[model samples]
Target chain A: MDLLGINPVLLIASLMVSATPILLAAIGETVVEKSGVLNLGVEGMMIVGAVVGFITAVNTENPAIGFVTAAIAGALLSTIFATLVLYLKSNQVATGLGLTLVGLGISALLGKPYEGIKSPTLQSLDIPILSDIPIFGRMLFSHDAMVYVSILIVGLVWYTLKYTRVGLVLRAVGENHDAAHALGYKVIRIRFLAIMFGGACSGLGGAYISLVRVPQWTEGMTAGAGWIALAIVVFASWKPWRTLIGAYLFGGITVLQLNLQAAGVAIPVEYLSMSPFLITIAVLVIISARGNQGAPASLGRPFHASN
Target chain B: MIHFEKRLNPSRITTVVTPIIAVILTMIAGGIMFAALGKPPLEAIRIIFWDPLFDPNFASYSRPQLLVKAGPLILIAIGLSIGFKAGIWNIGAEGQYILGAVFGAAVALAAYPADSVLLFPAMVVAGAFGGWLWAMIPAILRTKFNTNEILVSLMLVYVAESILASVAQGLLKNPEGYGFPGSRNLQQYPSAFNAEVIANSGMHWGVISAFIAVIFAYVMMTRHIRGFEVRLMGEAPKAARFSGVSTTRLVVFCLGISGALAGLAGMFEVSGPSGQITIDFNSGYGFTAIIVAFLGRLHPIGILLAGLLMALTYIGGELAQLMLGLPGASIQLFQGMLLLFLLATDIFTNYRIRIGGSN
Candidate 1:
């Protein structure tokens, strides 16, 4: 029931909750990279989603509306990046960094009034028969709608990327945009859509933090979850299913660290708190060292039709 | 419909003008934002851009603050521009900055009650080493394991922050004061204090170092073979490789120098303006320096001016925060706008717009 003064059941439940945001963000970014576009503004998009979602939920008293608006806001923000990088041919890295700065600054300004104000949170959806089952049900089947949605999204991404015609085109574009363009595929248009999708997913992840996770408005509440999601994409080698695993692993670590701190573990609190980032670095090194980094060949490369 | 045609040679005028245009655009957009927030747009603009330099009431105080603020930004940005020139991104200058401060402060703290003339200089070296050590993590990883330096460096930022928080509360805590989560104030120590070389003029050792860096960078970039290799690598990797440029060495050198400069900036800051190692000592200077680098067009002299301009915004933003009831974040929003516009307008530098072109 308990491991090291921590409840495994509760830990699993909370890990599912904590991992949802990162899973959503990483899955979206995988698609974006697959289209030969790299958006490093995940943190910015996530925070924007957090603030906008929290504000909407507080004002409308509807968590669903909050999430929808958050997605819209994120998509809208990503359009700026899409235009700059895809159309104007701005440096992808610098533009992405700019998006983050804009997102952080704008989110802070918007969330200023909503600070400390609690918003409507989602209720756990208990499937009747599953709820009646024993410990396994509690561990797996008792999460909110978004949790199910996140897993469902991952499944959809995996299937789409593996088997679909659209996925094939996206892969072609990512592998070599000029060749894709030569084949008469619309590279810029596809990348634009991919970026927007990425923004929306990042937004949803951010809203998950502000709504279900913390259930309140806080400036920079997402912290480095967005960045971690980015790391997960790499650790997953751009695979959706692996992203889920990476997210869960990260979520578990986060929860375990918090629990350890609460239980007054002998290790210094700061060291415990820093474990997730350190682990991220370790995983990144391990994945890269294996020689099959599996990154999209055209990842982070700016595309121009003439070029 | 309009389309862009790549210029055979990028327009020199547009290269200089685009940043100015970007600034003007940001002001207009920021004004609209301020108006939306129920503040007077024109007055807010004046407070942010104009008042910091010429508003008689605040100028004398703010003018000196400019160099104090610009010093670190220029130092860090100058270092970053070098790596950026080589197409090497070191966005983790923020982490490097933190480690530098921690390392530099550690030397002073460990040598507490000793008034040796060498204390300050020793701290400076320690600060640079700390930053270099931290930067080496990503550099070594990139060279050996082929990991993305951007992610690794950024992740280390959180690690460094954790270290900062730990030391502030544990090892570096001020023993004479009540148990507070910060190191001893280095400003109070005569030997460690980074005093203003000229009173009220803000010409401190850090500002002097920034000037020196600018001059050094200018010379190296224009005259040195290493600088040519860096530029060549960014422009054409194949060509640089053909010329026998070692990618590993370039990566290491760029990351190393940038990290050292970022660390030096942090050292100057903790010993001077910040005065101690605290949880919130770094106020996003590392990140802001990125914008400064771009705005300066990665040119040393340009970065100096850009750093000063950025420092002006910081002072003016503070003035606006006090004079007008604008939120502190609005300034961040303004700076972000500046960078976005700069990027957006940069197309003019490299392309000629063709109206009614059928391609």
Candidate 2:
């Protein structure tokens, strides 16, 4: 009973940690979708990021370096996706699925030797006076660096999409790539960049799992977090702040399930394990029912420049 | 500088040759991967591509296994291709597959130890219906709520996995088998078993169903008005609409047929090779069927050949693991590479690449 006890403050704080990876990935995906590129390979990128980040941190002993390398790895993989979809004009849905297959296979192959290996733990930072603010401090000011970074990224992405020229260009590209091209904006270049950024964020999220959350290497460690991130992007209605809410809500569900399991709740373990996916999808259905009017008009549509 | 010039008519020669070219490229790349892992590239490629068919010692065993492996793949891919050609993506056939197995197995489990000729047939019907019902979740959602079917279907796979695990450990656990988390082996139950039809050839109800599906799909795509409507819808949705094709109905039909086929594959697999409801009965035939569907160029005959080739890889990959100690992940990477190269080279089918030319 004592071991399974759930403290409200601790539960809320842990929710932030659980949410960070999806938050980072969803925020990045929102940017990519805004640019009219729907990269369904977030799972692939995240797993690749997880394995590469784990190996890098294992060799360098620095989680920061691991995260950066993971981002680079994710971006590099996304380039393959970009080339296939953008240049070759392959089906976006099929290409994205292919990318995921490639990522899972390659990551499993790469992480084979690193199985059962452990890396240095990521330490949480404490704010000076804020750390003394009781429940609020522990809940808000006591997370690892990535937690703060994820929230900061949401803010940065929201500001960029809402108040900047580049943001307008991205939104314009997503709304109608042909019209954006007519306006003389480089549609392909903008989309390519956005896809790369999304890949990087997904990588960082994967790295957070391997280097911070579990701090160990395992094949397919990201599980379906990537898929959850995709659902969250839709649940957020393509909005950054809503993405934050969706991620936390999902993260909260995940953490709460584990706590329930520990508390020896009579619910079947399988049902609890499946709740996050079911809940996210249910929300997606409800949100889309109200109408997907916010979807970028050109979402999932390939772009071509006429001569 | 290079430019891709769109062709007014896709090259017939390229359509036939591109898949071959992509396959050769996969071989070369896969050979390099083997060499990197310190195995003889030639021997590895020979074992994967050639030995499965010709090796006297392994041929008899591998030959039957090929049919066993390809049966489900072909069955599922046939269903998937129908929807794919109609532009309705049922990305979660895997979920339908799992539910079908559960539903079919439940029927058999309920009649355990009974010697009735009707048990297996009942299981088959239950399996197909189970799959169709599972598929309806996405279909209804897409038509009614206008939600993205791809994401929804894929998400349901995870949920289905959970249900599979629950059933294996709970409702389906064998009562008389020392508390093991699996049902009574269908193989031991003659009434409920999907027994081999012809002695020692691995021919079963599943393989027969696959052959039927292939022929049905071929005729549907080539000789039916519905097939033309499907192709028109995929190539030009607005045109399809103008031609009086009901988009909603087409979506439902595509999803329903695919789901039923996927379910049939699951039922056959569970009753035949798998023999019981276990925690990990699904070996990802559903996901792998997607690759098979595309590799076949979404053509019925092409899928048949593709299914055999993929089945060969599975057998050969296992052989390589035993003989050369190559990790299993390498084979998965090889499969993914095939799809990547296929997509990359498909460009040549519809466009000519101009070198150093300004369009």
**Best model per lDDT:** 1
Model 2, residue pairs in steric clash: none
Cα TM-score of candidate 1 = 0.99
- In model 1, pairs of residues that clash are none
lDDT of 1 by residue, B264-300 (tens): 9999999998999998888999999999999999999
DockQ, computed on Cα atoms, for candidate 1: 0.77
Worst 10 residues of 2 chain A by lDDT: A1-10
Question: Lowest lDDT 10-mer window, candidate 1 chain B?
Answer: B350-359
- TM-score, A chain, model 2: 0.98
lDDT of 1 by residue, A31-101 (tens): 99888888999999999999999899999999999999999998999999999998899999899999999
The superposed Cα distance between candidate 1 and the true structure at residue A250, in angstroms, equals 0.9
lDDT by residue for model 2 over B238-320, one digit each (tens)? 99999899989998999999999999999999999999999988888898899999999999999999999999999999988
lDDT tens digits, residue span A95-133, model 2: 888899889999999999999988876899997899789
